[model samples]
Target: MGYGELIIRSYDPQYDRTRVEDFERKCEVGPAKRVFLFTDTLGDPICRIRNSPIYKMLVAELGNQLVGVIQGSIKLVTVHKPPNDLAKVGYILGLRVSSLYRRRGIGSSLVIKLEEWFIANDVDYAYMATEKDNKASVKLFVDRLSYVKFQTPTILVNPVSHRMSRISSNVELAKLKVEEAEAIYRKFMSSTEFFPIDIGNILRNKLSLGTWAAYPRGESWSGVPSSWAMLSVWNSGELFKLRLGNAPLSCLMYTKSSRLIEKLVPCVKLPCIPDFFRPFGFYFIYGVYREGPLSGKLVRTLCRFVHNMASKSKDCKVIVTEVGGSDTSRLHIPHWKSLSCPEDLWCIKALKNEKKNSLHELTKTPPTRALFVDPREV
Candidate 1:
């Protein structure tokens, strides 16, 4: 069927659940892995985004065949620039078109339809992310449409080690009541990109374990933090896992060798896991912010604390988080010797007149600066 024949509609549980999931499964893949073998709620479209009012799921159908799917949400985002602007924007994600139906404008059509959804909701700015090397996606977002590659971000992952290190004695990390966390976020992180206006609700969500903040070991203050920083831990272990059955033949041949390479480059902390391995249990820390000259220490302490918490758990084995490379705050997160984890590219476009002055040329590689997009938003 032609692109014109494709029907784009909001996801319907009764009629579209299975087909929509199949399309998503067909699209989900690791950089090296051929397929994702296990089925779990992690990344499950229906379970994750289906119920939220802001979240919308759409699928493209042609003659009873599901060809593509996309999901997005409308949110009020904070811009770091002067005026520390607040914008009603659209965050688009999980855009996928079946391989057989691609190159015929199906993906583009899905995007256009979603753009309509954004405009109708009074959102003029839209943004999304993809791996740095996803050339086809780059072309689709930048060339076909007028999107700019704004930031490059790394996904930092630390495995739960058997023997965990202690968080610095200077840092008295305490779990904050949701109310306290919300207040701190407003004071310190409000200018952060994609900082949610309803931060309290986000912290209290089922998937969220809790939010913690760091204060000097001895301090008595209320309202806004003097040099406060906070981060929220997300329970992703319950979300999903990578199944062993999905391992490619190359994975089998390289597992032992890859392990050796990883050990040799331990300082780099490179991700060389065999595609066949299962990612059973993990925690991801997000909504991190800190102030002061030693704020980076607070960031590192938070990461270590979260990783240690996972290490203490019987089922958990990994800890992960993403930060915009342009974000100087990420320097506070641990990385060394220029060998870092995979850095993802974030691109954005303006549906109306909002971002014309702000958007830059994709070909222009500017110096990295501060960029912050809440991981939950993506």
Candidate 2:
């Protein structure tokens, strides 16, 4: 059958089992495993894409034969803050065309159809992510769909090797309590656009794994301070772990699948600026502080804490983080590099409404500045 003969439809409960199974088979990766890892079904990851509420599942059928499938969702651009117009953005999650139908434009057709749905639902911009190594997929997004390069994130891997790298010591790294951490975070980020790190969100979302502060050890601060936090998920033999910590100065974040420490050691062994960069692990740092001595120390200690945690997980391979528009300097850390550019879902309609047409390039935007989008409503 031809592409036009195929049909793309919204998700139906009757097709959930079939769709999930087909996705598992087409990818040679189980949906259950993928969903679980992304959602931390057994628990919660520091940051999760699977937890988004607005998933739209689409399937392509040729006279009843399931030839391909694509999943997309509407999300609020949460990273951006106020004074910037708030808008709903669309993200294409899982787009799979069967191997036999590879050359066909099934994926493209699916995206167009998805865009229609997005437009009808009042979405202004659509985005999707593909592995850096997937040239074909990248071409599909860029050349065919007119989707500009949104973000380029470097994917790093660390293979599991020695025990020392996997375990965390009770060594008192930084002595600041939760309150102190929050205070430092707030002060440093006073000029930026970030959610006030409330203790409630942290407790409710379980966001406190790697948080450390610079305040005197015993002093109690009122709430969770505003500091950079790193989130991670580990996939290893008989163990899966998710961790989050407040980043002080500098940290490394990358993605991997397995044998994380061993694979990362080679990169660490390279001549680098900081001796602490010599560790094997895969995870991404969402943000890191570059100014102030206290903040710098906090960032370094947090990086070390995350490294130690990864050393313990046997199944993890990849770690990913979304860096801010202003903080490209962190990407220069010897062990770290630019994975992708900061591509966000911007609304031309909103800009036009506000009588502003031109916007700065992603690289030119300050890292601390962000446009916040709440995914729940999207």
Quick one: best TM-score, which candidate?
A: 1
> For candidate 2, which ten residues in a row score worst on lDDT?
32-41
lDDT of 1 by residue, 22-78 (tens): 666556543333544443445465554432448788888887889888888887766
Candidate 1 regions with alpha-carbon error over 4 angstroms? 1-4, 30-39, 42-44, 50-53, 80-84, 216-228, 239-276, 279-281, 328-342, 358-372
Q: Which 10 successive residues of model 1 have the least lDDT summed?
A: 361-370
Q: Encode model 2's per-residue lDDT on 79-123: one tens digit a residue.
A: 244325445667676677877777778889998888888878877
TM-score of 2: 0.58
**How much is 4 displaced in model 2, in angstroms?**
7.8
Local accuracy by lDDT, each model: 0.68, 0.44
Scored against the true structure, residue 101 in model 2 reaches a CA lDDT of 79
Candidate 2 regions off by >4 Å? 1-4, 28-50, 78-84, 131-133, 156-162, 165-203, 206-290, 294-297, 314-319, 322-378
lDDT of 2: 0.44
